[model samples]
Target: SQTIHQWPATLVQPVGSPLSLECTVEGTSNPNLYWYRQAAGRGLQLLFYSVGIGQISSEVPQNLSASRPQDRQFILSSKKLLLSDSGFYLCAWTGGAGAYGYTFGSGTRLTVV
Candidate 1:
Protein backbone atom coordinates (compact mmCIF):
# COMPACT_ATOMS: atom_id res chain seq x y z
CA SER A 1 0.00 0.00 0.00
CA GLN A 2 2.31 2.71 -1.24
CA THR A 3 1.17 6.30 -1.27
CA ILE A 4 2.55 9.70 -2.17
CA HIS A 5 1.91 13.10 -0.64
CA GLN A 6 2.29 16.59 -2.07
CA TRP A 7 1.27 20.10 -1.01
CA PRO A 8 0.09 22.87 -0.98
CA ALA A 9 -2.68 21.95 -3.37
CA THR A 10 -2.65 25.39 -5.00
CA LEU A 11 -0.19 28.23 -5.04
CA VAL A 12 -0.04 31.80 -6.32
CA GLN A 13 3.25 33.64 -6.49
CA PRO A 14 4.64 36.67 -8.19
CA VAL A 15 7.08 36.23 -11.02
CA GLY A 16 10.73 36.18 -9.99
CA SER A 17 9.94 34.76 -6.56
CA PRO A 18 11.34 31.55 -5.20
CA LEU A 19 9.45 28.26 -5.20
CA SER A 20 9.66 25.12 -3.13
CA LEU A 21 7.48 22.00 -3.44
CA GLU A 22 7.80 18.81 -1.47
CA CYS A 23 6.83 15.21 -2.09
CA THR A 24 7.10 12.14 0.12
CA VAL A 25 6.24 8.49 -0.16
CA GLU A 26 5.16 5.88 2.33
CA GLY A 27 4.99 2.08 2.32
CA THR A 28 7.69 1.61 -0.23
CA SER A 29 11.43 1.60 -0.47
CA ASN A 30 13.93 2.18 -3.26
CA PRO A 31 11.20 3.26 -5.59
CA ASN A 32 12.01 5.45 -8.54
CA LEU A 33 10.75 8.99 -8.07
CA TYR A 34 9.83 11.42 -10.80
CA TRP A 35 8.91 15.06 -11.07
CA TYR A 36 6.65 16.15 -13.91
CA ARG A 37 5.12 19.41 -14.99
CA GLN A 38 2.02 19.79 -17.08
CA ALA A 39 1.42 23.13 -18.65
CA ALA A 40 -1.99 24.39 -19.59
CA GLY A 41 -3.28 22.21 -22.42
CA ARG A 42 0.01 20.35 -22.63
CA GLY A 43 1.03 16.82 -21.83
CA LEU A 44 3.13 15.72 -18.87
CA GLN A 45 6.76 16.68 -19.16
CA LEU A 46 9.43 15.06 -17.06
CA LEU A 47 11.44 17.51 -15.01
CA PHE A 48 13.61 15.20 -12.92
CA TYR A 49 13.96 11.63 -11.66
CA SER A 50 15.87 9.80 -8.99
CA VAL A 51 16.96 6.20 -8.73
CA GLY A 52 18.35 6.67 -5.25
CA ILE A 53 19.39 9.26 -2.77
CA GLY A 54 21.59 11.99 -4.18
CA GLN A 55 21.24 10.53 -7.67
CA ILE A 56 19.03 12.63 -9.90
CA SER A 57 18.43 12.85 -13.62
CA SER A 58 17.14 16.02 -15.23
CA GLU A 59 14.95 15.63 -18.26
CA VAL A 60 14.31 19.27 -18.98
CA PRO A 61 16.43 22.35 -18.81
CA GLN A 62 14.36 24.96 -17.07
CA ASN A 63 14.37 27.36 -14.14
CA LEU A 64 13.98 24.53 -11.68
CA SER A 65 15.90 21.79 -9.94
CA ALA A 66 15.21 18.64 -7.91
CA SER A 67 16.81 16.88 -4.98
CA ARG A 68 16.41 13.55 -3.26
CA PRO A 69 17.81 13.74 0.23
CA GLN A 70 16.19 10.73 1.84
CA ASP A 71 14.82 7.40 0.72
CA ARG A 72 11.33 8.72 0.14
CA GLN A 73 11.73 12.47 0.08
CA PHE A 74 11.96 14.49 -3.10
CA ILE A 75 11.94 18.22 -3.40
CA LEU A 76 11.56 20.64 -6.28
CA SER A 77 12.97 24.12 -6.00
CA SER A 78 13.41 27.21 -8.11
CA LYS A 79 15.49 30.27 -7.41
CA LYS A 80 13.38 32.68 -9.43
CA LEU A 81 10.07 31.55 -10.78
CA LEU A 82 9.13 32.58 -14.29
CA LEU A 83 5.71 33.27 -15.74
CA SER A 84 6.06 30.22 -17.94
CA ASP A 85 6.72 28.11 -14.86
CA SER A 86 3.13 28.32 -13.82
CA GLY A 87 1.60 24.89 -14.27
CA PHE A 88 0.49 21.71 -12.57
CA TYR A 89 3.31 19.93 -10.82
CA LEU A 90 3.09 16.24 -10.11
CA CYS A 91 5.15 13.78 -8.15
CA ALA A 92 5.15 10.15 -9.18
CA TRP A 93 6.80 6.85 -8.40
CA THR A 94 7.14 3.38 -9.88
CA GLY A 95 9.02 0.20 -9.20
CA GLY A 96 10.81 0.35 -12.51
CA ALA A 97 10.40 1.01 -16.21
CA GLY A 98 8.79 -2.32 -16.97
CA ALA A 99 6.72 -2.24 -13.82
CA TYR A 100 3.20 -1.10 -13.22
CA GLY A 101 1.98 2.37 -14.08
CA TYR A 102 3.09 5.32 -12.01
CA THR A 103 1.36 6.43 -8.85
CA PHE A 104 0.96 10.20 -8.72
CA GLY A 105 0.30 12.30 -5.67
CA SER A 106 -2.23 15.08 -5.39
CA GLY A 107 -0.69 17.67 -7.62
CA THR A 108 0.16 21.28 -6.94
CA ARG A 109 -1.16 23.97 -9.26
CA LEU A 110 1.09 27.01 -9.38
CA THR A 111 0.16 30.34 -10.84
CA VAL A 112 2.95 32.84 -11.36
CA VAL A 113 1.58 36.36 -11.38
Candidate 2:
Protein backbone atom coordinates (compact mmCIF):
# COMPACT_ATOMS: atom_id res chain seq x y z
CA SER A 1 0.00 0.00 0.00
CA GLN A 2 3.00 2.31 -0.43
CA THR A 3 2.50 5.45 -2.46
CA ILE A 4 4.55 8.44 -3.57
CA HIS A 5 3.23 11.98 -3.88
CA GLN A 6 4.59 14.86 -5.97
CA TRP A 7 3.10 18.34 -6.28
CA PRO A 8 2.34 21.12 -8.74
CA ALA A 9 1.76 18.70 -11.63
CA THR A 10 2.87 21.35 -14.11
CA LEU A 11 4.86 24.55 -13.79
CA VAL A 12 6.11 27.39 -15.98
CA GLN A 13 8.79 29.62 -14.54
CA PRO A 14 10.96 32.44 -15.74
CA VAL A 15 14.63 31.78 -16.21
CA GLY A 16 16.72 32.12 -13.02
CA SER A 17 13.72 31.59 -10.77
CA PRO A 18 14.03 29.29 -7.79
CA LEU A 19 12.37 25.86 -7.70
CA SER A 20 11.25 23.45 -5.06
CA LEU A 21 9.71 19.99 -5.64
CA GLU A 22 8.78 17.63 -2.93
CA CYS A 23 8.13 13.86 -2.68
CA THR A 24 6.95 11.76 0.18
CA VAL A 25 6.18 8.10 0.72
CA GLU A 26 3.55 6.48 2.88
CA GLY A 27 3.03 2.88 4.06
CA THR A 28 6.73 2.33 3.92
CA SER A 29 9.85 3.20 5.90
CA ASN A 30 13.44 3.90 4.89
CA PRO A 31 12.83 3.08 1.28
CA ASN A 32 15.46 3.86 -1.33
CA LEU A 33 14.39 7.15 -2.88
CA TYR A 34 15.42 8.78 -6.17
CA TRP A 35 14.84 11.79 -8.38
CA TYR A 36 14.84 11.60 -12.15
CA ARG A 37 14.35 13.92 -15.10
CA GLN A 38 13.07 13.06 -18.54
CA ALA A 39 13.36 15.35 -21.50
CA ALA A 40 11.18 15.34 -24.59
CA GLY A 41 11.02 11.82 -26.00
CA ARG A 42 14.08 10.86 -23.98
CA GLY A 43 14.82 8.35 -21.26
CA LEU A 44 14.82 9.07 -17.58
CA GLN A 45 17.98 10.60 -16.13
CA LEU A 46 18.96 9.85 -12.60
CA LEU A 47 19.42 12.99 -10.58
CA PHE A 48 19.66 12.24 -6.87
CA TYR A 49 19.00 9.41 -4.46
CA SER A 50 18.90 8.76 -0.74
CA VAL A 51 19.26 5.68 1.39
CA GLY A 52 18.47 7.20 4.75
CA ILE A 53 17.48 10.40 6.43
CA GLY A 54 20.08 13.13 5.83
CA GLN A 55 21.90 10.92 3.33
CA ILE A 56 21.84 11.92 -0.32
CA SER A 57 23.73 10.97 -3.47
CA SER A 58 23.88 12.90 -6.72
CA GLU A 59 24.21 11.05 -9.99
CA VAL A 60 25.16 14.14 -11.94
CA PRO A 61 26.53 17.54 -11.06
CA GLN A 62 24.00 20.18 -11.96
CA ASN A 63 22.25 23.33 -10.77
CA LEU A 64 19.88 21.26 -8.66
CA SER A 65 20.12 19.64 -5.26
CA ALA A 66 18.18 17.13 -3.14
CA SER A 67 17.71 16.37 0.53
CA ARG A 68 16.07 13.74 2.68
CA PRO A 69 14.76 15.52 5.73
CA GLN A 70 12.90 12.48 6.98
CA ASP A 71 13.05 8.75 6.42
CA ARG A 72 10.34 8.91 3.78
CA GLN A 73 10.58 12.45 2.51
CA PHE A 74 12.78 13.80 -0.30
CA ILE A 75 13.04 17.27 -1.71
CA LEU A 76 14.57 18.65 -4.91
CA SER A 77 15.46 22.31 -5.17
CA SER A 78 17.21 24.81 -7.38
CA LYS A 79 18.31 28.30 -6.46
CA LYS A 80 18.20 29.46 -10.08
CA LEU A 81 16.57 27.36 -12.70
CA LEU A 82 17.96 27.21 -16.19
CA LEU A 83 16.11 26.75 -19.47
CA SER A 84 17.97 23.49 -19.76
CA ASP A 85 16.38 22.43 -16.49
CA SER A 86 12.96 22.20 -18.10
CA GLY A 87 11.80 18.62 -18.16
CA PHE A 88 9.58 16.05 -16.50
CA TYR A 89 10.77 15.47 -12.95
CA LEU A 90 9.88 12.25 -11.20
CA CYS A 91 10.30 10.78 -7.75
CA ALA A 92 10.62 7.04 -7.21
CA TRP A 93 11.43 4.47 -4.61
CA THR A 94 12.46 0.86 -4.29
CA GLY A 95 11.79 -1.52 -1.46
CA GLY A 96 15.57 -1.93 -1.19
CA ALA A 97 15.03 -5.62 -1.71
CA GLY A 98 15.59 -5.52 -5.46
CA ALA A 99 12.88 -8.11 -5.81
CA TYR A 100 10.50 -5.75 -7.61
CA GLY A 101 10.63 -2.65 -9.73
CA TYR A 102 10.44 0.98 -8.59
CA THR A 103 7.26 2.87 -7.71
CA PHE A 104 7.09 6.28 -9.37
CA GLY A 105 5.22 9.47 -8.66
CA SER A 106 2.94 11.27 -11.12
CA GLY A 107 5.83 13.60 -11.99
CA THR A 108 6.21 17.35 -12.37
CA ARG A 109 6.62 18.96 -15.76
CA LEU A 110 8.76 22.07 -15.61
CA THR A 111 9.08 24.64 -18.33
CA VAL A 112 11.57 27.48 -18.03
CA VAL A 113 11.12 30.57 -20.11
Candidate 3:
Protein backbone atom coordinates (compact mmCIF):
# COMPACT_ATOMS: atom_id res chain seq x y z
CA SER A 1 0.00 0.00 0.00
CA GLN A 2 1.27 3.48 -0.86
CA THR A 3 0.49 6.53 1.21
CA ILE A 4 1.36 10.23 1.23
CA HIS A 5 2.03 12.23 4.41
CA GLN A 6 1.83 15.98 4.97
CA TRP A 7 2.06 17.90 8.23
CA PRO A 8 0.56 20.75 10.23
CA ALA A 9 -2.98 20.08 9.08
CA THR A 10 -3.52 23.78 9.71
CA LEU A 11 -1.16 26.73 9.89
CA VAL A 12 -1.26 30.45 10.68
CA GLN A 13 1.80 32.31 9.53
CA PRO A 14 2.63 35.94 9.30
CA VAL A 15 3.59 37.50 6.00
CA GLY A 16 7.31 37.14 5.10
CA SER A 17 7.72 33.99 7.16
CA PRO A 18 9.60 31.05 5.85
CA LEU A 19 7.60 27.97 4.82
CA SER A 20 8.49 24.35 4.52
CA LEU A 21 6.16 21.52 3.65
CA GLU A 22 7.21 17.95 3.25
CA CYS A 23 5.60 15.04 1.48
CA THR A 24 6.79 11.48 1.52
CA VAL A 25 5.55 8.34 -0.21
CA GLU A 26 5.77 5.08 1.61
CA GLY A 27 5.84 1.67 -0.10
CA THR A 28 6.57 3.24 -3.43
CA SER A 29 9.70 4.15 -5.34
CA ASN A 30 10.35 6.88 -7.86
CA PRO A 31 6.72 7.96 -7.83
CA ASN A 32 5.75 11.23 -9.42
CA LEU A 33 5.20 13.78 -6.68
CA TYR A 34 3.34 17.05 -6.84
CA TRP A 35 2.59 20.17 -4.86
CA TYR A 36 -0.72 21.82 -5.54
CA ARG A 37 -2.53 24.83 -4.17
CA GLN A 38 -6.27 25.35 -4.26
CA ALA A 39 -7.86 28.65 -3.55
CA ALA A 40 -11.18 28.73 -1.78
CA GLY A 41 -13.57 26.75 -3.96
CA ARG A 42 -11.15 27.00 -6.85
CA GLY A 43 -9.52 24.27 -8.90
CA LEU A 44 -6.17 22.84 -7.95
CA GLN A 45 -3.17 24.68 -9.33
CA LEU A 46 -0.02 22.74 -9.98
CA LEU A 47 2.84 24.44 -8.21
CA PHE A 48 5.67 21.96 -8.51
CA TYR A 49 6.34 18.36 -9.40
CA SER A 50 9.14 15.84 -9.43
CA VAL A 51 9.73 12.76 -11.54
CA GLY A 52 12.84 11.51 -9.74
CA ILE A 53 15.35 12.37 -7.07
CA GLY A 54 16.98 15.74 -7.67
CA GLN A 55 14.50 16.49 -10.42
CA ILE A 56 11.85 19.16 -10.03
CA SER A 57 9.66 21.14 -12.39
CA SER A 58 7.65 24.25 -11.77
CA GLU A 59 4.29 24.59 -13.39
CA VAL A 60 3.90 28.28 -12.69
CA PRO A 61 6.11 31.20 -11.82
CA GLN A 62 5.64 31.68 -8.13
CA ASN A 63 7.32 32.27 -4.79
CA LEU A 64 7.74 28.61 -4.05
CA SER A 65 10.33 25.99 -4.87
CA ALA A 66 10.30 22.19 -4.78
CA SER A 67 13.10 19.74 -4.22
CA ARG A 68 13.33 15.97 -4.35
CA PRO A 69 16.17 14.95 -2.10
CA GLN A 70 15.32 11.29 -2.19
CA ASP A 71 13.43 9.02 -4.50
CA ARG A 72 10.24 9.22 -2.46
CA GLN A 73 10.66 12.48 -0.66
CA PHE A 74 9.56 15.87 -1.89
CA ILE A 75 9.79 19.23 -0.21
CA LEU A 76 8.13 22.56 -0.92
CA SER A 77 9.78 25.64 0.49
CA SER A 78 9.74 29.38 0.33
CA LYS A 79 12.27 31.80 1.70
CA LYS A 80 9.51 34.24 2.46
CA LEU A 81 5.76 33.91 2.42
CA LEU A 82 3.22 36.14 0.75
CA LEU A 83 -0.30 36.97 1.80
CA SER A 84 -1.54 35.53 -1.46
CA ASP A 85 0.07 32.26 -0.53
CA SER A 86 -2.78 31.40 1.75
CA GLY A 87 -4.67 28.40 0.49
CA PHE A 88 -5.09 24.67 0.75
CA TYR A 89 -1.81 22.91 0.08
CA LEU A 90 -1.98 19.33 -1.00
CA CYS A 91 0.70 16.76 -1.68
CA ALA A 92 -0.08 14.07 -4.18
CA TRP A 93 1.60 11.16 -5.91
CA THR A 94 0.99 8.82 -8.82
CA GLY A 95 2.73 5.80 -10.11
CA GLY A 96 2.16 7.09 -13.60
CA ALA A 97 0.01 9.58 -15.34
CA GLY A 98 -3.38 8.30 -16.56
CA ALA A 99 -2.83 5.33 -14.33
CA TYR A 100 -4.35 5.18 -10.86
CA GLY A 101 -4.53 8.92 -10.88
CA TYR A 102 -3.32 10.70 -7.71
CA THR A 103 -3.21 9.75 -4.07
CA PHE A 104 -3.36 12.94 -2.06
CA GLY A 105 -2.44 13.73 1.49
CA SER A 106 -4.89 15.07 4.05
CA GLY A 107 -3.69 18.52 3.02
CA THR A 108 -2.62 21.64 4.93
CA ARG A 109 -4.82 24.66 5.29
CA LEU A 110 -2.54 27.72 5.43
CA THR A 111 -3.67 31.12 6.53
CA VAL A 112 -1.34 34.03 6.00
CA VAL A 113 -1.90 36.84 8.42
Clashing residue pairs in all predictions, respectively, total 0, 0, 0
State the local distance difference test value for candidate 2. Answer: 0.95
Q: If scored against the real structure, what TM-score would every candidate get?
A: 0.97, 0.97, 0.96
CA error at residue 96 for candidate 3, angstroms: 2.7
lDDT of 3 by residue, 2-110 (tens): 8889987999999999998888889988899999999998999999988889999999999999999999888988899999999999999998773889999999999
Q: For residues 1-113, what per-residue lDDT tens digits would candidate 1 score against the true structure?
A: 88999988999999999999999999999989999999999999999999999999999788999999999999999999999999999999998673798999999999999
Residue 100 error for model 1, in Å? 1.1
Cα error of candidate 3 at position 71, Å: 1.0
Tell me the whole-model lDDT of each prediction, alpha carbons only.
0.95, 0.95, 0.92
Please identify model 2 stretches exceeding 4 Å from their true place: none
Candidate 1 pairs with clashing backbones: none
Q: Which residue ranges in model 3 land beyond 4 Å of their true spot?
A: none
